[model samples]
Target: MNVSDIKWEYIFNIELAIENFGYVLSGIGYTLLISAVGFALGLIWGFILSLMRISQLTLLNKFAAIYISFMRGTPTLVLLFLLYFGFPFIGVYFDAVPAAILGFTLSSAAYIAEIIRSALNAINHGQWEAGMSLGLPRQKVLWRIIVPQALRIAVPPLSNVILDLVKSSSLAAMITVPDIFQNAKIVGGRENDYMTMYIMVALIYWGICSGYEVLQRKLEKQFGSY
Candidate 1:
């Protein structure tokens, strides 16, 4: 397939691609599922960790510090491999997808915790004092006032983290998880159209990330006024 000789009109093998498309689509579905579950879990875990970091209890703060340190120090792929391969010795036999989710979620939780802590710190001390003066409970003040403001300030970086998560999902292909890159590799091997397949995959990823940016901008505009 010389550059000039390669036919642009060369029809994409839709039938063959369709037959294999399910695997590809399944890979993408797995990618999205892992990201969604991982991020959601991270949010909850991170919130708790953030609270712990800010708590007056020395033991809880130490635990949060250690968890964030461990996860942040390790690469996500290494973490995934550890969970998938090492856990079986301890009787926790997670399949590839579950392992990926678990690892990513753990890693994400660490970063998210730090992000939330920073956001929490960014809130003014006056806000807390004012809330307390109004006779609002500590939990109520955090839930009803502080958290909302912190989240708005946190959205930009948080959105960036999500974008990284989406891209990081490509690593799942290494474990034969059938994500977009894996799909492109398989198709390119069959058709010998490596460039086209890769280009298409890049476009797809770009499309998703671009859409996220648009949504992020809308969110910033809508909520940033606070």
Candidate 2:
């Protein structure tokens, strides 16, 4: 069908959408929870993965490389299904929310690891030499001298990962997590106004991502001075 042939006016119910907006907005809590917890945990795990990637131990380095490769290669939806559904086969189970958080964490960590790894490598070898000249141990040089500088470079990409996690949290609906997109689906089904409901949900997501962009800027400013 051609775009001009479509009935745009009949496809959206602005009044119905506005009245049910609150129900959709109510799901933002779950959305933020999944995104924030997932990101926080992923950051910790990803930093470790980054360290492992850079380690001299071949076992740790190869393992980290394979992990990052696997996570980055697979679709997160498959991961969510494995966590929420497949785990029950082995007598391990997670309700939708925990499953979603786990999925996002596992998925985001690979990207975060790469971001951190590149940032670490990007730092000049001069910093390492300088730290050694000061009689600091290698670990101390990494943590005290290199990491702080690497963090500034890592901030932008890390912020992007958080924003992506937030947006991707919508997929939690597939596992019945009742996030914002899920709630929108509920309202849409109830009101039979799918287009309107989805449009509003998209706008809400845009608003959220915009807020994260602002936060990213603030983080950049803070880190830029460090």
Candidate 3:
């Protein structure tokens, strides 16, 4: 095979490739689903963990500290293996897609918790005092004023992480989620167009990540005045 003169048609056929494009889209759909679930779950879980870290109660604070430390210290790949394979030893068998989502969510929550905690700490203590002077309850003050500003500060980093999650979701192929890369691999193998198929997949990832970068910049600009 002359590498330079390799004539390639769209795999199976151009019509077949088009049909499989729909399958590839399905894979991307599942990828988006996993990211969405992980992001939302992480947001809620991380918010609670942030509060626990800042709590005055010794036990609550200590538990949160350990949780954050452990998660931060461990690799996400190891965490995913534990959730998918190790948990089954204890009679907890999560399906592959769910396992991937849960693993990503746990990792995301740990990072987001720290982000929230640091953002909260960054505000001047006088702000809390000012809120109290205005007769706002502590929770009300946090919800209305402190959290809003903290989220503004956190958005840039969080958006970067979310974009990372989207790319990281390629790992879902390991658990058989049929994600974009996996579909590309399958098609590339059948048609022996590995380079072309994977190149297309890479372009897809780059396009999505670029969109996220644009969104992140817009967010930072919008929040700069706050």
Candidate 3 segments whose C-alpha is farther than 4 A from its true place? 1-22
Q: What is the C-alpha local distance difference test score of each model?
A: 0.83, 0.93, 0.84
Evaluate residue 165 in candidate 1 and report its C-alpha lDDT on the 0 to 100 scale. Answer: 83
Which ranges of candidate 1 are over 4 A from the true structure?
A: 1-26
- What's the TM-score of every candidate structure? 0.86, 0.96, 0.86
Query: What tens-digit string does per-residue lDDT give for candidate 1 at 1-226?
Result: 6889866544454455555555555567776777778888888999999999999999999999999999999999888878887889999888778877888889999999999999999999999999999999999999999999999988898888778888888877766677888888988888776666666677677877888899899999988776
Tens digit per residue, CA lDDT, model 2, 124-168:
999999999999999999999999999999999899899889889
Estimate the TM-score for candidate 3: 0.86
RMSD per model, one decimal: 3.5, 1.5, 3.5
Residue 198, candidate 3: how far off, in angstroms?
Answer: 2.3
The lDDT of model 2 is 0.93
Residue 148 Cα positional deviation in candidate 1, in Å, after optimal superposition: 0.9
Shift in Å, residue 126, candidate 3: 0.5
Scored by lDDT, the top model is: 2
